[model samples]
Target: MIEIFTDGASSGNPGPGGYGVILKAGKYYKELAEGFRKTTNNRMELLAVIKGLEALKKPGNEVTIYSDSKYVVDAVEKKWVFGWLNKGFAGKKNSDLWLRFLQVYKLHQVKFVWVKGHAGHPENERCDQLAVKAGQDRQRHQIDTVFEQEANKL
Candidate 1:
């Protein structure tokens, strides 16, 4: 089983946003993060998980994800996402991300565990650092079209 810790940070709502992910399989580990010029916290949060799953090299892998975002954890763990999908995601934000997520989500055996941010968890702490660092490193980071694309629908 692979253990993944994920976090997303935004300097401001609709401001610079980024996600940090740390993956560990045995002694080998990898960290991934990137910043978007403008995005929301929830978007970054969900995106972090999506990107983390996308990074996996194989299907049928058992992966446990640690995340601080209730938006993500509850949607999956509490099964609200299925209900939302049944309703065609009406009145929902980030349907794009959610749809994108489901595509990759189905390929793995995945579970989500909620963790409190700023707590003492090791991988969570590292992900926080990486997220903040990437958010701060937005000098040359490209604008994420998803935010603009979705915002246009409103």
Candidate 2:
């Protein structure tokens, strides 16, 4: 089985944001992280999971994801994403990310486990640290084009 721990952070609700991911399979491990110049915490949260899944080298693996975001955990655990997909993601925020998630999601048997953030969970805390550092590193942050475009539309 593969275990993944993920976290996201933002300086402001819709400000600079980033995600951190830790993937482990037996003794093999990998970390993924990136920052977005303008994005939401929820977007970063969901993106962390997506990035983790995308990093998997094999298909049809048994995977479990640990996250602190109820927004992301509940959406997948409660099966809301399927409904959203059925309706073509109408009235949804982050449709781009959600769609990207679905594409990578189908390649594995995935489960989500929710944990309390900042509760001293070692891996989760490390992920949170990575996320915050990435978010605050302005020089390395990349544009969140979809978010920027949506803001421009308003």
Structural similarity to truth (TM-score) of each candidate: 0.95, 0.98
- Candidate 2 vs. true structure, TM-score: 0.98
Q: Model 2 off-target regions past 4 Å?
A: none
CA lDDT, candidate 2, residue 94: 92
Query: Which tens-of-lDDT digit does each residue in 25-123 have in candidate 2?
Result: 899988888998999999999999999999988899999999999999999999999999999999999999999999999999999999999999999
Model 1 C-alpha RMSD vs. true structure (Å) is: 1.2
Question: Model 1 lDDT vs. the true structure?
Answer: 0.90
| Tens digit of per-residue lDDT, candidate 1, span 34-72 | 988888889889989999999998999999999999999
lDDT of 2: 0.95
Q: How accurate locally, in lDDT, is each candidate?
A: 0.90, 0.95
Q: Which stretches of candidate 1 lie over 4 Å from their true place?
A: 152-154
